[model samples]
Target: MKKVLPFVLLLVAVVLALVFPSVEPVTVADATFDTGDTAWMLVSTALVLLMTPGLAYFYGGMVRKKNVISTMLQSLVCMGLITVLWVIFGFSLAFGEDIGGLIGNPATFFMMKGMLGNQAWPLAPTIPLVLFAMFQLKFAVITPALITGAFAERIRFNSYLIFLCLFMIVIYVPLAHATWHPEGILFQKGVLDFAGGTVVHMSAGWAALASALFLKKRTTPAHTPARVSYVILGTGLLWFGWFGFNAGSAVGAGALAATALATTTTASAAAAMAWIFFDIFRGKKPSAMGACIGAVVGLVAITPAAGFVTVPHSLVIGVVAAVISNLVVLWRTRTNIDDTLDVFPCHGVGGMVGMLLTGVFAHQNVNAGNTTGNGLFYGETKLFLTHLVALVVVSVFAFVGSYILLVITNAISPLRVSAEDEEAGLDLSQHDEEL
Candidate 1:
């Protein structure tokens, strides 16, 4: 009762404010005024902003120390490159007025047409257009960064810059519009991606797979592949930032955001346990790296469903995702594909798992007017079928599109470095410095 008193009082205040509105409602006069929703979004954007650097460290630690800086730079560089493109035309191409259900018109290039004061393209009522842009910027910053993990230790720096430019315009923008735009085919068809299971994770995962196939593997295995400390630190940062990634998707300081926060935490915890158990069963002690990776998989799995499912459902989803991703990673290594950082296993498998489970676990009670109606427990199976269709379409498009892009990139310039460069390592050969 003591703990419940504060919540009770808060609820009363909300109800009173809604019921007995003031004669003149307060308005945020400043475009950047610190309203509750705006404040939350600002913090959320910062959290997601941290993830790019965190991803750099995560991939950096996985590669040999000789190539650590080079590997990390791949992610870091995308932050700047993608942000510039996004401001120029990427946002307009993605979130501008829809054109015949295909793509957004480029009417907002350079943010020229819509001034800072314009609310025409606002994502959240309380947050300014610029704030929304910055939030989405974080998403754009991370997707290409995820791909660097796949072709790490290979791939020329010049070609990579070209690839990112092409990818942001051709791939990420279209997909973001397809899933997120108000009139998007998937969104109109009742697909329930609360965050970016399809848009970000699935797309990045498939692209990573294509990159691995095109780039080929390192000629020799890493001399010392273990960087447990760096991996652990990177994982910790990712976990912290993911709260914004999932909860911030709600776009408001409301009940939905609170629910998303709870589910995200629960799923991550469950996945961590599941990974540790799998390691124990495999006759190895679960290392900190394994546990951290498992937690990330769980978080990814629940990303699309964070605001749609109950906390208990998120736990189940996370555990299942961790187990499946762990097995997939192990199985991929047995083949010659050489997905350097297991992107296909972690993000690809986890995204697929989350998309499907979203259909099973999504409940209308959580968010009224949710298009799916009810969850499996509530006797709705149609949503599950729709999820399957979305998964297949996204997977096929991402994989095929990425493969073609890689082929084109390779044709323009050699994708991998020369044999001498490969032997000497990217840090020394490409950057002229060694970590």
Candidate 2:
């Protein structure tokens, strides 16, 4: 039953996709698709998709040898599972017609019935609607994969599988719709998220914190990281893929994309340096894990502000995020909570820093997206205040929503592995495989 469960679920999803009625195609107006933009989006989608395997390696290297395969699979399986979900109804819930400002009308694009090559997505006028959906699909795939780091090696495989579907449907879809869709409540309120500072990093980070608190500490003794080299390689890939992640949000092969790419590189490099220097000041040798985590935190910090902030602003954001996340990781180590891989400190805190700083440093000269208001440093208060409110709202929603999902999944199937499974390790116990 365990072996066939995924196949069964996948078959069901396929049947549903085939049976759902395809609504009549909407008449597209005079919008013309740009071949240049379409080409860039195609490349960008592939780059974003690469991040998941990179993530698998990144998370895999941090677990014990006995759990590496399971740890990696947690990240890898999302590529398969979320794709099916997205094709069925996930995209509809995210990018379908607005529903009361909180969600999309699932019927708007049910089963991707109306998302055809001829249709142009209103949000991205220059690209094909199909390409837009595919780009967004990559983002959906990676969000839940990020949460797996918090509970790594100790979660039941079946429970994690169940939680993945629930998280995407109940948490991610609404948040994405609310923040990115044109009529979304936050979007209407003039919130500025160039990429997914609030939708992706913040949601994943807060949920990770909740997972750690709910799961409690691991029963088994801690082990050293299985492979630092793998961590470094994964970091390199994530760094590479992030260019596509942030820049691609422009939805066009234009100057904005170029600016975003530049800022991403600067921020990541700045954060990596800051982390290593901070570690050295603490009397510890420079560590590969620290550098990788710091780089990723920087990437998270710049995601929301990539298009609106200048290159110099990105440097400051990276330095600040690195220091703050490093401190939080240190603080967390002293507490009873075992967050396995510090997902919350690095992603959650880093995302908050980015959102707030974007409110402070945003400049209209940098990009045309800042039509609403600039940051606090630019003598404007509205954007900063709005970001603060958003931070509170999103944090509460992600934490509370995720906790409820965890509880529900636990009720259906125990979330934690048995003590015997823990001793034997997740790779062998859960999947009957060993590294």
Candidate 3:
């Protein structure tokens, strides 16, 4: 009892922090800007930033110990590489003025003209354009990083770098523009991705599937199975960062942000429970991997609906997403296709489920003007159909583009290492270091 008291007290404090209302309102008039919103976004950006490293650990622990450092480096290196690319041209191509409804112009390259003197873009107010750019930088970094997991333990470092550059230019930027920009085709068509369900998760997940197919399989089975403790720690960090990823999408410190936060938490919890229950029903003990994967599925599913769905509706979305993604992972393992880290199953399947459910559960009372006033149960099924269209289009584009890029990359240099290098492990063979 004595040993557990400290942990109990810490948990109580966290609960109070979450539930307790602030007596004083933190507003912009009280400072240089909307301090409350700025503070929240800043914190959110940092939280989202942490997820890349969390991804590193998550992917790292899944590979053989000899290749752990190399696998982890793929994610960590993207943090630096993508940040520069975003500032240089990635952001402009995604968020700048539309060009023929297909892509954004390079009007804001280097964020030169638009970022002067705390200038605000039309898309988000209260926060500076620089803050918005940095917030998005985290997303740009993680999408390609997610693909690293699919090709883990075998990809050449130089080829991986080349692949990231191509992915950012050819696949990620256009998808991000289509989903996130106000004048984007999907946005114009009324797709309701509050954060990045289609743009980030689906794009990365499908690309992961393509990469896994193109790369074939690792030459060696993992000498050391994934470490459960590392998986748990990575999951915890991802959960913490996801609050920023979802809630920050609201771009304000208001009721919408609160709604997003609530929905995010509810969905994650519900999915975790559902996954555990499913494991028990299958005659297997609940696993840390199941909990981690379930939490991620919930996060992915809610990304498009975080600000639109009610708490209870979000719970349903999470539960259903977990079941679908779990089944998809199981089905994929039965095939020869080796999605090394199940990225397609969790993110791709969860994104599709969430997108459809968002249509079913979306209510006018929540975030109004969401195409349909009432949900599917309320006799409005157009939203559901629209979601299905978005999923199919995004999936096709991602898979096809990724496949072409992989073929091009293979022509330039081998995508996978030699069998001897694979046996020695990527960390030593590619980086000249033993884990």
Candidate 4:
């Protein structure tokens, strides 16, 4: 059944891709598309897609060998399921015309009806509407995948499948619309989220925390990571792909992309260093796991401020996120919250650090589109205050909404595996496979 399910999903995806070609029936007049920008977006889409596999390795390495395949599959399945959903209506609900400023109007681009060829997306005016949709698809694909690290090795596969769909429809899409759409309530309020600090990381982070709490602690308290090397490799891939994740948000081959690329690079490097140093301070050896986690936290922290802040500013963002996440991980061990891999500390807390710091250091000079006003450093209070409000709103929405979805998913089918299956591990019990 597992093998057949994947194959059927793939077949549906192939058909969707073939049916939705690079041609549109209706074209907008005077909508100019640039070849250079199109070429850049093509690469960016592929790069963003690579992050999912990178995430699989990241989460896979952190679990026991008995559950590695299941851990990785949790990340991989989203690529298929979310792609099908996005093409059908996820894109429309996220980026289609506004509906009361909360979500995209479903009728605007249902089934991707109007997105292709010469049609230009208002967000990325220089790129094809289809390309923009595909690019955004990558973002939607990875957000839910990030939450799997929280409840790894214990979740029922079928219940998770259902939860993934609900999370996207009820949580992710609305957050994306409210933050990214020009007419979005948050966007109109002058909140500046250059690349999903609020929309992606914050939402996923809080949900991860909620999921961990709802699932309760693992029956066993201690478990070992299967492979540290895999963690290192995953970190490298995530770091590489993040260039596209952050810079690609520019949606053009322009100066903004370049600045974002520089900031992303520096932030990760600085965070990695800060993380290892913190370990040294705690009288622990500088471990590869710590390094990788630090680097990823840095990447998460800089995501929101990548385009709005300068490269040097990213150094502070990275270091701060690493130090704070390190502290949270320490605090977590003292509590009963079994966030298996510290997903909340690394992503949720790191994202908050980045979002708030963006309010502190963001500069209009970095990008000429400075309508959001300057950060605290520039003596402007509006942008900083607005980010605070957004942080609170997104956190509440994600935590509460995710809890409800889990309740619904549990009602349909138990969310946790049976005690016997969990004891045997998800790889063998859920999928009849092992590495």
lDDT of each: 0.84, 0.91, 0.82, 0.91
TM-score of each: 0.90, 0.97, 0.90, 0.95
Backbone atom clashes (below 3 Å) for every candidate: 0, 2, 1, 0
Tens digit of per-residue lDDT, candidate 4, span 1-435: 543765786687678668765355767886799999999989989999999999999999999999999999999999989998898789999999899889988767777887654788777888888899999999999999999999998999988998999999999999999989999999899888888888899999999999999999888858999988888888988998998899999999999999999999999999999999999999999999999999999999999999999988999999999999999999999999999999999999999999999999999899767698899988989989999988998899999999999999899778999889999999999999989
Candidate 1 local lDDT, 298-327, one digit each (tens): 989999999999999999999999999999
Question: For residue 145, what is the lDDT in candidate 1?
Answer: 92
True lDDT of residue 46, candidate 3: 95
Superposed model 4: Cα runs more than 4 Å off = 1-24
**Whose TM-score is greatest here?**
2
Candidate 1, which segments miss by more than 4 Å at Cα?
1-34, 118-123
Show model 3 residue runs off by greater than 4 Å. 1-33, 221-224, 369-373
Q: Residue-wise lDDT of candidate 3 within 1-435, one digit each (tens)?
A: 534643664475456445542333223332245788888889989989999999888778777787888988999999987876676668889888888656888765433334645555566777877788889889999989988878887788877877887899889889888877878898887788888888888888888999999989776543464576777888888888989999988887888989999999999999988998998888889988888889888998998889888998999999999988988988988988778888999887788788888888888788864654556856887777777788889889999999999999888767899999988878889988875
Question: Model 3 shows how many backbone clashes?
Answer: 1
Please provide, for model 2 over 208-314, each residue's C-alpha lDDT reduced to its tens digit, 9 standing for 90 to 100.
99999999999964679999888898999999999889999999999999999999999999999999999999999998899999899999999999999999989
Query: What TM-score should be assigned to candidate 3?
Result: 0.90
State the displacement of the C-alpha of residue 394, model 2, in Å, after optimal TM-score superposition.
0.3
Give the least accurate 10-residue stretch of model 4, judged by summed lDDT: 1-10
Residue 191's C-alpha lDDT in candidate 4?
A: 80
